[model samples]
Target: MESQLQQLVRHTRVHEIVGDVIRVHATGVALGDLAEVQNTDDEISLARVIALDRNLASLQVFAGGKGLSTDATVRFLGRPLDVVYSPNILGRIFRGSGEPMDGGPDLSTEPRVKVGGPTVNPVMRVMPTKMIETGIPMIDLFNCLVESQKIPIFSIAGEPHSELLARIGFQANADVLVFGGLGLIFDDYYFFRTAFEEHGVFARTVMFVNQASDPLVERLLVPDMALAVAEKFAVEENKRVLVLLTDMTAYADAMKEIGVAQERIPAVRGYMGDLYTQLAQRYEKACDFKGAGSVTILTVTTMPGDDVTHPVPDNTGYITEGQFYLHGGIIDPFGSLSRLKQHVIGKATREDHSQIMNAMVRLYSEAVEAQRKQAMAFELSPFDQKLLRFGTLFRERFMDIRISMPVTEALDLCWKTLAECFEPQELLMKQALVEKYFPKDVGPVAVNEAPIHG
Candidate 1:
């Protein structure tokens, strides 16, 4: 039956072939239609129509255009790229092309859905009011991750951002997690699979990986594929889906490479002019459907040479709610901010949460100032000494990425740290909160029970 269907589709001879892209002069080809390219060697490849004119259609071949000629036959499938979506996809790993890579049964018989559609409408969105805890003090306590929020982790190259993302995937409070790894090395890909399986979250995870050795065009498809399935889970199944993409810089680089291949003019930092629009199209997919579940996006966008002004992170900062600045192996509390936290911090958490959060950050800032003063050989006051001690304890107890705890426990530790550092009158937080939540007698902070890998 499939062979008969293929025989019915008309085939057009390739008129022009660019690097990994072929132009076919056809009458009825539509944009985003899938196509099959048969090279002179009789080797077959898959492609998708990226641009369409009156009779000229440009298709991006999934397999690179290495060996081909005008003699090649291009058959348009008359449809966009799609994937088989079902509950069985929950625990599977797939290539960027959406083919199963886990040696599992084929999902061809399942219902299919098209990818790269428009984002949800504003009227259909519910304002995010719920917190998504990740069991990390830096995120859950300081910059709370809200449901349906789009945010990024800004870091430099050679960081543990991937490890951090895997930890969140394992510990995050969500019904489903879809991870898209773009341009990753084989080692990195292996690490994620091992981590997910060992942590037992693989049962709820769906991974789409585009390795460095893979064709560059597939890197462009990973995020869209992950989000398309995630949207199905969130809207149809009413499941809270969390999507994580690592090293979006690589994805942006892939886009730039493809844009250059297409002969488009470059914008800032030698990237495509439509960089912002392209990024927003993916980030805007994070939506909390009214009376349904939500989709939250937490991506890692590494800055080249640690330059935030680079086109990728610069445009991303504008679209996202806020960013997590990961520096020196920690989520910098001073650098990170969550705009939607206000919707959940005081309301969903304890009464002292907002006050305690403010007080800790304020004192940490003062402690940093005191350290600078001491470095300049300035005379130190008694309060400065207290701040110095407080800063040291804060970093050791809270700022370390390995410190994992629930929000309530983090709040308790905050009070304990403050009580040990300053007298009640010295701390300027609300008197009621201080008397209510503050520890009466300073003692040792509780020993961490969660594994460090989490």
Candidate 2:
């Protein structure tokens, strides 16, 4: 019976154009089948019927239209946007849309999997305690990277965030590095690739990058694609995976695009209301699979206008364990924190690790105050003089992100630097620690005078 009315097949897959993206579900179609998409607003594009669907068909429309008439054809794509996946892709780079950008040959039907899917089960979770050291004192010495910990480097434009990520990729003691670069300019992408190749770590790393010129929607798929590959490696190959996702703000902006497309109601700062849930779904992927390897996510979330309360960073702060704040060409000691460091610092490191770390920071903080006093032309006490010295050396030696050293060497260097600046009593450290770490005065002050220059 050919009736004028065609019922949307019951139990057929449906997708809601909510949240700027319409995700397909088996029964989601039934919910909006009666719904019609019409070009009510001049801004919305009128969707053309592509196919009639019970199972999957194909649907491509001109312009993203809000008032989609139910009478409009909704031919399905038979599947979600499938992404190619294979172990042979371990050391490759790809565009945001999952196309190889590394000038490699086509994957040639190795098999493709969809990105941006649901997370693994929580019951399969394992507590985090393992440490992935980058050999950079600012990170390894202070904010220790724990296995399966999800963290962010909060920064703005022009920070060495990209270089820092590259350093970690090369130095971190992890089996795999899966980097998802979202919305990077050409030079930025070029830097990462060159850095990895120069260090000869390209064989162990993989990148999924979305550049500034690519379609905006493609940016949304990068992190998910990178993570998807990471998850597979961990569960199947038991590889210790370190996933680095840069410029999360780009991902957030993409979310906003799809949200507006679905005509979804906006939440704080014009982002979709489900911001937290979306971030959590991605970050919660950091975990140690039982009897297998782990996944640790370290991401870049650039603060727009340097405002921490900018909706993107504000929400990310809640999701990640803590942040490494990059400012003023340095990883700010005060702003950077590792909430999970408590679990691994003393346990995974040396016995005096906690004490030395705390004491060093306390001394550095005092040094800052001394420097400020010096700037005000205040008379410098002997202690102030010592602190001022310590602060100068601290910034040059430890605080500089470019300074890389083993954790033990860093501690030893700390002791040496302190001893050179002040007497043992002035340090006020535990006598036992002094006795062990303090260098003995072997000789009097050296006289290397090239005839005193006035």
Q: Which of the numbered candidates is closest to the native, going by highest lDDT?
A: 1
**Candidate 1 per-residue C-alpha lDDT over 1-454 given as tens digits, one digit per residue, 9 for 90 to 100:** 6665654367989988889888888866667778999988889999988877788888888988888788999887877899779999988999989999989988989998899999998999988999999989999888999999999999998778888888988899999999999999999999999999999999999999999989888899999999999999999999999999987899999988887777779988789999899899999999999989999999999998989888899999999999999988989887798999999998988889888888888898898888888778999998887787788888888877777898999999889899878888888989988889888888533332221110
What is the lDDT, from 0 to 100, of the residue 143 in candidate 1?
93
Per residue, candidate 2 scores C-alpha lDDT tens digits across 52-93 of 345432222233334544333333222345567778887799
Per-residue lDDT value at 271 in model 2: 95
- C-alpha root-mean-square deviation, each candidate: 4.0, 7.1
Q: Can you list the residue pairs that collide in candidate 1?
A: none
How high is each candidate's TM-score? 0.95, 0.82
| Residue range with the least summed lDDT across 10 consecutive positions in model 1 | 445-454
Clashes, model 1:
0
